[model samples]
Target chain A: MSKPLILVTNDDGITAPGIRKLISIVNEIGDVIVVAPNSPQSGKGHAITINSTLSFEELNLDGPQRDFSCSGTPVDCVKMALDKILPRKPDLVVSGINHGANSSINVIYSGTMSAAVEAGVEGLQAIGFSLSDLKWDADFDQAEEFIKEIILKTLENPMPKGIVLNVNIPKLPKEDIKGIKVCKQANAKWEESFDERTNPHGTKYYWLTGYFNNMDESEDADETALANGYISIVPVKFDLTAYEYMNELNSVYQ
Target chain B: MSKPLILVTNDDGITAPGIRKLISIVNEIGDVIVVAPNSPQSGKGHAITINSTLSFEELNLDGPQRDFSCSGTPVDCVKMALDKILPRKPDLVVSGINHGANSSINVIYSGTMSAAVEAGVEGLQAIGFSLSDLKWDADFDQAEEFIKEIILKTLENPMPKGIVLNVNIPKLPKEDIKGIKVCKQANAKWEESFDERTNPHGTKYYWLTGYFNNMDESEDADETALANGYISIVPVKFDLTAYEYMNELNSVYQ
Candidate 1:
């Protein structure tokens, strides 16, 4: 049987340690191709380059893998890979061994998940991996075995159509780590407070800063699962339709 | 009581005719403050500027409406407006009288809808308006009365918490247009086929082009309403959680 083809990408530039680890792990399972943004595209949720031109350069990085760096957001990288770089449709698309968590509301602001979402939008099986630690050198060692297990499982039994997996690993050692739990996104948000500062020219500008606040008590939520030391896996879809409210709102409009 | 403070913004840039018309209509409803992108930010879905420095300049062209043009995405404009510009928390936020349709699957790629979603994240009542026509010279006169009615009603009775409206107006004249219908997002998607072309340098590039394909047979979808010449008002929220699937998937993980 032919090996499963895995397409990998990330938002934290092509040289980030996260994607390197991701590429190494996936290489053990299948043929891997890494296409990612040339620079950090944090918080670049689903944005695509429309007004400007796009360029992709093939790279000969120190790895036994195919790689390309694109001058665009994560969504653009996925599109470029699928349209320009890949020889054929990949069996699975995986984004991120990200520097930080994409649990709860963070998934909406995530470039990592956006790539995964874009892949799912193109009718491919996709998954986004995020660790709960932000430090660049945070231990991804613990996530290796589970990552392989999940990838193997996904390749064996494909995900449902239009659904992508958002898998977040809790910051724990392999021995200390609990099993994965399927969960929903917590009703959480960031309280944005811009730090007003003056530029060198004495002109006032602002830096967007925020503290994440998760107040949902729902134990079945991704936030809750992460807080309890389990790796949370949420089945996410790109459609934002509030189907239940349609009938109630339609009556009001009529 | 002082009228509810309403923060107005759009993805079409502060000087776009569509937003100017929106500001004019919103000026009568509340103390309106406009803060939008300095240039067109189409397709910047939920993106926020993190690595770049942002600046803003007061514009004199908001036409009797106080306006600031920010060098950022639609989400950044909303954050800056809330944290730096507005004196206090706004009771409501309205984004766009956008020049093109943000209906069905387009909402995921829309900078217009992202502004409104940002407001909902901040716990403010919000709505995004888009007309079917893409012309810069498109007549917005027909939408005046219904827009006013929707805004007035929204201010009087805010949306259910965490819900924001994605409203798309049909392109018909005022007399020919049917009234609004609250609908769910249609199960529609963009089928991308890149338009490959050669530059003057003989290097080939591609323009991201696609047609909208609606797969849902449901009559109560946004695309169905818009196709039938009725304005569609879809109550959308940022929570992309597939809640129903969580329980069923949990069984697998365990």
Candidate 2:
């Protein structure tokens, strides 16, 4: 049988240590190709380049996988990768091994998960991985085995249509890990906090800063799972429709 | 009591005619404040600026409302407005009078809807308004009464928490329009089409272009309502969790 084809990407730019680890892991499983943003696009959720043109250059990176960096958002990289670079439709699209957490409400602000969601939007199977640690030299070694296991399992048993997996590893060693937990997105958000500062030019500028507020600590919540030292996997979807509220909304308009 | 504080914003920049019309319509209804992007930020779905600084300048626009043009994405405008400009947490947040349609699947890629969704995330009553016509001089006069009715109704009869309204008007005259229909988002997507070209330096550059493909023609869908000459309203939620597939996904992981 032919090997599975995997496309790897990240929001931390092409040369980040995180993507390099992701490439190494997926290389053993499939014919891997890396198409990612040329710069860090951490909070660029589902953004695409509409008013601008896009360009990309091939790279001679150290890996069996082919890598190219595109001058656009993470979603744009996925769009451009599918249109220009790939020889055929990839069997699976995997993103990240990201440097920080995308466990709950962070998914909306995360470029890593947005790339995965964009792939899901295209009707392809995709997954996004993130570690709870933000340090560049953060230990990715612990996530290796479980990452391989999850990829192999996904390849073996495909998910339903319009669903992708968001996997966030706890910031603990492999031995300290309490195994994987499939959970729901926790009700969480960043409290809107902007740090106001003044520049030397006499004009005032502000920096967007926020404190992470985990509003749900329920057993099934991804935040709870992560806090309990388990890798949390939440089945993610791109459809933003609130199905439960439709009938009531219909009545209101009627 | 002071009138309802209605915050108005858009992805088409603060100076666009659509917003000017929106500001005029809402001026009679409430004490309004406008905080929108300095430039057009269409298709900037839910993006925020974490790695940079932001600046805004207040302007004395024609209405009772104060207007500020901020150097950030649509989502950024909402955050900044809440954190700095507004006198208090707003009574309502209204986005757009967008120059194009945001019915059905278009909501995922829309900065107009993103701004509304951002407001919804902050637990505010929010609504996004869009018109089917993309013309600079498209007629918005037809939507005045209904927009007021919806806003007034929304204030009097609050929608359930965490749900925002996505209202799209068809390109029809006031009389010919078939009033309003509350509906669900149609399953639709942009058929991936990239226009590849070479720059003067012989380097390849691409334009992100596509045809809108309406996959679902269900009578209750937003697209269907719009196509049949009625304004469509779909309740949008920011939570992208696939709740229906959770149990099955858990079993697969187990």
Candidate 3:
């Protein structure tokens, strides 16, 4: 049988160490195509460039995979790849090894996870991987074996339609890792404290700053798993409808 | 008793007719404060600006409500409002009367809905309203009474935490419109067809374009309700965890 076709992309741009590591691992598993944003798209969520045009250029990155640098957000890259670049529907789509954790509430603001979610919306099996460390030079190699194992396992057992995987690794050594845990998204949020500052012109401006507030102490929560040094995998769905509340809402509308 | 404090915002920017209509209606219901983006932020999803500084300027729009135009995405507008703008926690948060439909899968790509989701994440009662018409000058005045009714009802019945309402009005005249129906998000997606062209610099560029493809024909779907001329109210939740598949996922991981 021919190799499985894999589409690889990330929000940290095509050249980020994280995606580079991700691409390297996937290359061993499938025929890889890298369509990633040309610049960092952290926190871009599911943004598409609707008001403007987009472009892409082929790059000679150090890999067997074909690389295309896209001039849009991470979600845009996935759309562009499926529409204008890929020769066939990929067997699997993988996003990130994101520079920071998208463990809980961060998933909604994550370009990394959004790309994966967009693919899932298109009925493709997809996964987004992130590390808890936020540094550009974070040690991605530490969890290389585990990442490969997770990808292989997922490719064998494709996720259900409209569902995708959000995998986050703790910032620990490979030996210190306590394996994987399937968990629910922790009920958490960022308490924003915008840093008010003045520009050189003496005009006031604010920088977005926040602290993660995790309120879920449940053992099955992703944050709890990560805190316990386990790699957390949360099955995320794009069907945002709250089915349980439909009857209650119907009564209210009446 | 003190009047309810309502925070108003939208993705169509501060000066759009849709938001103007929203502000007018919200002003009648409570003490209103509008903090929306300075320019249009269509299809921005749940994006938040983290790489740059943001600023807001007070505007003298023709209303008893106060207006502030922020230089950020819709989600940023909500975070800025709660963190630095509002004097106290708002009693309710309403977003849009968006110039286009945020029904079905469009809710995932909507700036208007993202703002409402952001408020929901903050544990506030929130709702996002949109009109089926995409025209800039869509007759938002037609559904004024219905909009007010929905807002009042929602204020009276606060949604459970992590849940918000996505309300979409059909394009028919107010009298022709059927009553509202609470429904689930339809199984739908956008079939992307990128329009490629040659730029002035002789480089190839592409425009993102897509057609909505609704596969769901269920009577209980939001898209179906809209097609039947009924206003659709879908209860949207942000906790993406697919709980039903947790056991299945756990087995695979093990």
Candidate 4:
């Protein structure tokens, strides 16, 4: 029997340890195809390269899966894969196992989740996985069992239209880690600060910096669940319409 | 009496006529401050510049408002403006008088709308206005009155938190226009295609192109309203969590 076709990609460049671990894990369950950015695209959001031309090259990444690294954003990789590279429509599209977190409000600025959401927009069942750690050599070995379970369950039960799961793993050791929890997005924000610097040519420039502030403490929020030592799965959707305010907004036009 | 602080921005660069008109329109009602990209940033989506240094220069645009041109994406401009440029938290953030359509699924790839969404994330009232015409010389005269009305109404009646308006004006003569309609985002998508080309060096490159495919013909859809010659206003939100599917998804983990 043919295996389920899985498309694996990440926001961390193609050679990142995170995607390497993800590819190996998924290879055990499906026929994997790897199409990811050639360079890091950390906070690209749902960006697509419209003005520039794109080029890609084949890679020999010690895997059975056909791999190609493309010069584009994470969302662009998804589009290119669907249109040019994939053998057919993938059964599941999984992104990330990112080097950093993509939970709470971070999802809006996340290239990993944006790739997953782009797949959702194309009517594909997708998931984005991330760890709380920012290290390139972070411990992904601990997430093997739970990640496999979630992927298997998702394959068995397709995600509903317009929805995808954003799964974030706590940075705990294997045995000490608790279970998984389905939760809502936490109300968190980045308290941004700019580090000002002066160039040798007498010009001032700034580097963006910020710290994540998780404001929600509700038991069902992703932040709370992760704080309690469980992996948090938040169902994310692409429809940005605020349906509740539609009626009131209409009244304004009246 | 102090004027309301109105922050103006666009994805089409600070010199685009669309935003110049927007600046003029808002100047009548508020003290305007324009902080936009130094070059055209069309289709940049919600991207932010993380790995690069950002630079901005005060501009001498012919208006009562202060102007600054920044070397960043639309979302970056918003962040930079709020963090360093603006005198205070703007009473309202107005993005675009975008020179093309940002209706239906186009909203996802829109830098113009992303600026407003970023403002919404920062807990500010924001609106993104776009015209269906893509011409640099498109007529903005007809939109003057209606745009002012919407802005004034929005200022008088503050929008709820996390919500921003995406207003798309049809490219019709003002006389033939049928006012405005508050509508939901149409269930539409892009039928993406990549045009392949090979350089003399024999390496293949792809240029992204696509056409909008609107599958929803429902009465209250933004696409439907635009087709009927009416200005379409969709109240968009940044929170991506799908609430209804959370229960069923939780059952899977159980």
Candidate 5:
């Protein structure tokens, strides 16, 4: 049987340790092609470059996988790869061993998960992996075996169309990990407290700063699972419709 | 009783005619404040400017409403408005008399809808309005009464938290247009066909272009409603968890 083909990408720039680690692991499982943004695109959720042109070039990175760096957002990298780079439709598209958690409401703001969602929208099996730690050199090794296991399992069982997995691993040693839990997205949000500052020209500017507020206490909440030392897998869908509220909304419009 | 504090914003930048029309209509309904991007941010879905500092300056536009143009994406405008600009939490947040359609799958890539989703995430009553026409000079006046009615109705009945309205108006004259229909987001996607070309420097570049492929035949779909010349109101939620698939996904993981 032919090996599974995997497309690798991330929100972090092409040189980030997270994507490198992900590429290394996927290489053993599939014929890999890495198409990632040339610049860091954290927090750039689902953004596509419409007003400008996109350019990409092949990179001589040390890897068994072929690497191409593109000047666009993470979602753009996925689109570009599928359109211009990949030889054919990949068996699986995996985005990130991201440096931070995308466990709850953070999923909407995450470039990592957005790439995965974009792939899902394209009718491909995809997953986004994130670690709870947010450091550049974060310990991605801790979740290596778990990531490998998840990928292998997913390859065996293709995800439903319009659905993708958002897998967030806890920042712990492999031995300390409490295994995987499929959970719902927890209700959480960032409370923005912009740091107002003045530039050298004395014009006031603001730095975006905020703290995460987790409000879900349910046992099946992804945040709770992560807090309990389990790797959290949220089966996320791109259909944003609130089907339950349709009847109520109809009355309002009437 | 005090007037409703209506916050107005858009992805088409502050000076667009679409927003000017929106501001004019909103001014008559409430004490309005406009906080929108300084430049067009179309297709910049849910992006926040985390890596860079943001700046906003008050613009003396011809209106009764106070206007501020922020140097960021549509989501940033909402955050900045809530944190620094608005005197209090707004009674309602309305984004876009957008110069394009944001119905169905377009909502995922829409700056207009992202601003509304951001407001919804912050637990505000929010609605994103868009027209099917993509021209800057599109006839926004055609649906003024409908837009006003929708806003008034939403204020009377606040949206449930984590939910917002994605309202797309058909490009028809008010008289020819059928009344509103509460609907589900249609299953549709963009078939990307990159317009590849060479720059002056002989480097290959590509412009993102695509045709909308609406695969939905259901009568209750937002796209179907729009096609029938009726305004479509899709209740959109940000909680992306595919709850129905959790059990199936769990079995795979195990």
Candidate 6:
């Protein structure tokens, strides 16, 4: 039996505490290869570098870990690692320990989830992990056991093709943590209010600011699971086909 | 009755002929305001600018259009337009005469579609328009009538709340075109094959490239509609709740 090859990456640059923690965890489970953006690519969804040339440099940043920092989006890092750097197909790909939550609609805007989604598109078992806390020094000690368990479970029982797990952990002490809950993404959204500002030239511009509004009171929602002190695990599929509305729309088109 | 205020934008910078044609189409229909990226932001999906300052300059380009080239993503341009530029809430938001198709799963990574999705999130009626071809010299004349018809129809009859249209026009003569088909996004995806290359330092990197593989043979799909020379309009909503799978997974979690 061979050791599982684990490809690790994140939206928060390669040296961020989040991916460092992720790399440390995966190192115990499998052969770890880290390819992440040189700078933070937080909200850069599935963006690829079309106009720019991608560059990567192998770093001797840590002990026994192979790391490469790339000048591209999170999706680019995954593509580069899988298609250029890695000698063979990785058994699994994991993104994040992202600084912010990618639990609900934020998944669409998250570079962390996009890395996992990119791997899922390539038929690899993938998972994206995030903490509800956005603090730079946020503790990930509580999530270690569950994350490792989930990764091992995913490796033992592979995920469905094109599906990835989006796991959001609540910020809590290891003992205070509730068990994991498999749930659906809550029907929630970011209610945006752009903060108006003046440029140096006295011209007006805006900065995007928003409050996350979780309107779903459903018992099985990821938001509810997290609020109730449970680690929320949502099996997210990349196929954006609104299957239920198909028949109704087909009738209209016909 | 007062003229409806139409906010226009695109993923292809404000200079693209496609958007110019779109602005011209809507100018006749309503009072139009154009706010788009200064550069192409093709695959930047639902991303927002947080790490950097954004700027928008009113361009003095020669045309009937009032354009502002912004230093941000498509979603940013929309927020800036609504919050800092437009005096009041726009009656409708129309994004793109995109240089490429945003049909099927591509909608998840599309900046053109993101602009419209952002508008829809802000509780405004929005539509994203795309052409099948990616040519800078692609014919825009053939798109006028169909664009007008769809936009007028959309304005006349409101779409469901939180729903935004991801409309893809076949790059054929408008007369040869079959009527509009309200379709669902096909189960289609990009089969990514990265073009690996060695840099000046002899280190290898990868350029992400892929071909679209259609998995759905259903006649009601956007891919099917587009292939049949019909304009495919898939009403896309951002709420990613896989409701049916919730209860089933909840039992396992419990």
Which runs of model 6 end up more than 4 angstroms from their true locations? A199-205, A247-254, B60-65, B196-206
lDDT of 1 by residue, A85-145 (tens): 8889999999999999999888878999999999988889999999988888889889998
lDDT of 3 by residue, A1-254 (tens): 89999999999999999999999999999999999999999999989899999999999978799999999999999999999999999999999989999999899999999999999998999999999999999999998999999999998898889899999999999999999999999999999999999889988999999899999999999999999999999999999999999989989987
**Candidate 5 DockQ category?**
high
lDDT of 5 by residue, B5-76 (tens): 999999999999889998999999999999999999999999999999999999898878999999999999
User: Evaluated on chain B only, what are the TM-scores of all the candidate structures, in order?
Assistant: 0.97, 0.98, 0.99, 0.98, 0.99, 0.98
DockQ of each: 0.72, 0.82, 0.92, 0.87, 0.92, 0.51
- Sort candidate 1 into its docking category: medium
Q: TM per model?
A: 0.96, 0.98, 0.99, 0.99, 0.99, 0.93
- Would you list the clashing residue pairs of candidate 6? none
Give the clashing residue pairs of candidate 1, or none. none
Give lDDT tens digits, candidate 4, residues A104-189: 98998899999999999999999999999999999999998999999999999998889999999999998877899999999888
Model 3 clash number: 0
Residue A173 in candidate 4, Cα distance off native in Å = 0.5
Off by over 4 Å in 1: B198-204
Model 5 residue A187 CA deviation in Å:
0.3
- Model 4 bad stretches (over 4 Å): none
Instruction: Give the per-residue Cα lDDT of candidate 6 at A126.
Output: 92
Please report, in order, the local distance difference test score of every candidate based on alpha carbons: 0.87, 0.91, 0.95, 0.93, 0.95, 0.86
Q: What's the best-to-worst order under lDDT?
A: 3, 5, 4, 2, 1, 6
Model 5 C-alpha lDDT per residue in residues A196-252, reported as the tens digit of each score: 999999899999999989999999999999999999999999999999999999888
What's model 6's TM-score?
0.93
